[model samples]
Target: MSSRQTEVMPNFEQTLLKKRGSALTDGLSFIAYGAQAIANDEFSKCFAPKPRNKVISYLLKGLKAPLSIAGMGIRYFLLLPIRIFILFGASAGFFIALPIVLRLKSERLKRLLFKLYCKAFLWSWGSKIRYHGKKPVLDEPHIFVSNHTSIIDYIVLSSHGFPHATVAQRQGGIIGYFQKNILKLNGSLNFDRSQKNDRSVIAQKMREHVFNTEKSPLLIFPEGTCVNNEYTVLFHKGAFELGAKVAPVAIKYDKSWADAYWHSRTQTFSSQ
Candidate 1:
């Protein structure tokens, strides 16, 4: 066979391997979905009302709401110290490890670190994530779009296995400094969303980064601000102009145990 044919054979083999891997993952995912559905059904049946008085049921629900809130408050205060430790510790660790990751040019390691940090951070806050859909294949540049609801929305989404650099607003102060620098190391982009000129420049940069850089995938929450995950806001068409593939991901936090929504106006920086 010619050298060209030999090279083409390897590419064909790689494609076949990818297909098989995807098939196996799909099979396992289906099984997991089936099991989860069964478990949810069983749980609902177990807790379902047993022909009880409607008045009593309503009264109990009324009582449970306040009790649940109080319980969340207690848990938050109890875990305050640990949460603070994780925040600062993870920040420090990320910076310390970032230079090495950059020097080594290891995007995979960066992604793994980001994933672990997000999972740990969310767990500290008493929130657990349950994924329900297939994650987008990030083999090529695809705009990862999701609804913005909470400060921790990024954490939950990153933990869902799509590892991509995110776009965050530029800010000032120590936390902001840390965010700007650390995220920069991980191939994240920042821009001033207020100015139209800046937005135009940022859109151009996004297209270049997604197509030319060949680094990692890009994630952008088109909603300019968090809206408590109630409704989606208008998405900026900047990323869409590139005409790249789009990946839509739905992020839903289990609000039964903890309130994950971050109210920027009322919430203090140290509170969460």
Candidate 2:
């Protein structure tokens, strides 16, 4: 091919590439963000659209009726109820059980319940996830910080079902009594960020969770408070200072945080 033809070929291909990437952006960005994996690619990974290799396209390629029925039946009969039960259990534990029973103060329960709560949310709410492209992995137990839009971030990260500390601001003593109590029982390290000198002690504990002994991934929302998903706020240094890789997950919610405030009336991430 001539040099002129070479230049012309790239322009034609690039034009098609731009169109495909752009079309997906406007509609899919606000959903579960399976497409965000395309955006989540790191430095060594360059942006390249494969005409036949898009993630979602592949999932729907040849899926037949039998498998589709099995998927729904499984999710409803098995996955969803269990998830909902765990969520309600965790919620009750947060509001009723743990508070009445002081022994629930244990951090193990906190972490465990958080995982169950997250699992429930993902299985029940977030649809059957099919990666059309790349996906995020919990390589090491780092403080995973996200823009606090919905309580779902916890469930979203937790659905992956990894162990880690989840810190909350102990504003109304609500956290200390219920939220902190159950979260600790669930294998979480709970620290009230507002308490004086809590950072140093919590830092040591967090470092322990991140480095010493962890069965799963720890999650943190360092915006310090939940906000609208319209924009991402500045992250708190606690997550980064703990020496864990900060996995910045931008949860594009179908609705606003204000629309679904379960954990806190204003602050603290409570159990769903």
Candidate 3:
């Protein structure tokens, strides 16, 4: 009788809404296509620790997601050269057009532009970083520190431009040259850990960059080496000595180390 009445008086929107709203009687959810679909696709398996077939399907979807990432290896390799040309072009263009441009450079607008540049740089390599911590509103300046697991940390920090700085290291190839200029342009202090006297000089420079002015937060990677999924490496005191209070941050992800291959536990573990 209920089925017959539903069929005769079908309220398609209401009917779909109900179907999309709940878990299944078997303690699982019904999976369907579309945004906010008739069901949630990923549900826990019953009577077992591992996922059921439905869960497996959802996991597979996640695994194949990185194949969906359009560019990574090629773009990352080409990024520095491209940016170098871009920098040159923009600099020349800005100087030539400075008289003609009319938009007032507001302090608020400059900050917004800085944020946009940071986010674009981060996404260029097809890598995404998920952060877990209390995101500071940063009414004032402060230092940031993280585990140097990958070379992408600079982009992560660049997204926040409040006159912040980080320690600089040697350039290997393209990224090194591109990054050296980027950091220099942004006022980063170069630190050569291999040198004895250079260490003090570097620290003094960092202290000045962070403390001598309005006191922007210092960003440092306590673990000097990028961890290979092991526990954090021993922290160095150089970054902390500048009288900046520590704001410890941890970045962990299943797919990040792989960079672009967003799915599959096998690749995930390899990245870790």
Residue pairs in candidate 1 whose N, alpha carbon or C atoms collide under 3 angstroms: none
RMSD of every prediction: 19.0, 14.3, 18.4
Query: How accurate locally is residue 71 in candidate 1, as Cα lDDT from 0 to 100?
Result: 60
lDDT of all the models against the reference? Answer: 0.66, 0.55, 0.51
Best by lDDT: 1
Candidate 2, residues 191-254, lDDT tens digits: the string is 5655768878877877787774433456678776655544455676767877667666656544
**Candidate 1 residue-wise lDDT, 105-197, digit = tens:** 776887787777777777666565678878866666667888776656777777667556778777666547746766676577787767768
Q: Which is superior by lDDT, 2 or 3?
A: 2
What TM-score do all the candidates reach, one by one? Answer: 0.65, 0.48, 0.51
Maximum-TM-score candidate:
1
Worst 10 residues of 3 by lDDT: 43-52
| Model 1, C-alpha of 167: deviation from truth (Å) | 2.0
Model 1, position 215, has a per-residue lDDT of: 62
